[model samples]
Target: MTEPMTADQARAVVYDAYTTGLPQAAAAKLLTGRATPAWVAHEYAALRRRGVSSMAGQQTLFDTEAAE
Candidate 1:
């Protein structure tokens, strides 16, 4: 079996997915064995709370919606 992912690694994955416009729930599903949807949702909330500008210097769909 593969090793479990660290919290940081999971967060990074979630961040990358989120920046690509994937919803937190969908990203969580993608991490099936690595992280839970609840955990991913929490991390997503934290990112929103922190006002993360962007991972690739471009606003995400979610960001645009929030701005409108």
Candidate 2:
């Protein structure tokens, strides 16, 4: 049986998936992609820990990482 996810738990998972270099689109393709907007935002925030700033925007970070 599947367990229900809390808002906080969903956010943490989203953050982890994003930081691992998975595109938001791809992340969304997964069942968990339908997570709350707040979770997605939190995911972006977590990316900041990887030398990426949320204020810089997601596309910017993806392109920058690609170039590196």
Candidate 3:
């Protein structure tokens, strides 16, 4: 079995997928082991609420493992 991912890794994957305009379904497949697309969408919405729409914003949002 694959090792469980850290929250930081999950966040980064979600952030990158969203920023790159990946379809939610595609992201769901890509992240099946980590999170569902609905959950990814939820995180996307949260990031938008925080004004995190740019690459820099994504990095800042997920750069630190300590934050989670």
Q: Decide which is better by lDDT, 2 or 3.
A: 3
lDDT tens readout by residue for model 2, 1-68: 67777766766566655656666655555535457455565566566667763334356656866797
Candidate 1 positional error at 43, Å: 0.5
Superposed model 3: Cα runs more than 4 Å off: 54-68
Encode model 1's per-residue lDDT on 1-68: one tens digit a residue.
78888888888888888677677778988899788788888888888788874454345444676687
* Residue 9, model 1, lDDT: 86
Residue 7 C-alpha lDDT in model 1: 81
lDDT of each: 0.78, 0.59, 0.76
Query: Whole-model lDDT, candidate 3?
Result: 0.76
Q: Poorest 10 consecutive residues of model 2 by lDDT?
A: 52-61
Pick the lDDT winner: 1
> Candidates 1 and 2: which is better by TM-score?
1
Candidate 3: C-alpha RMSD to true structure equals 7.3
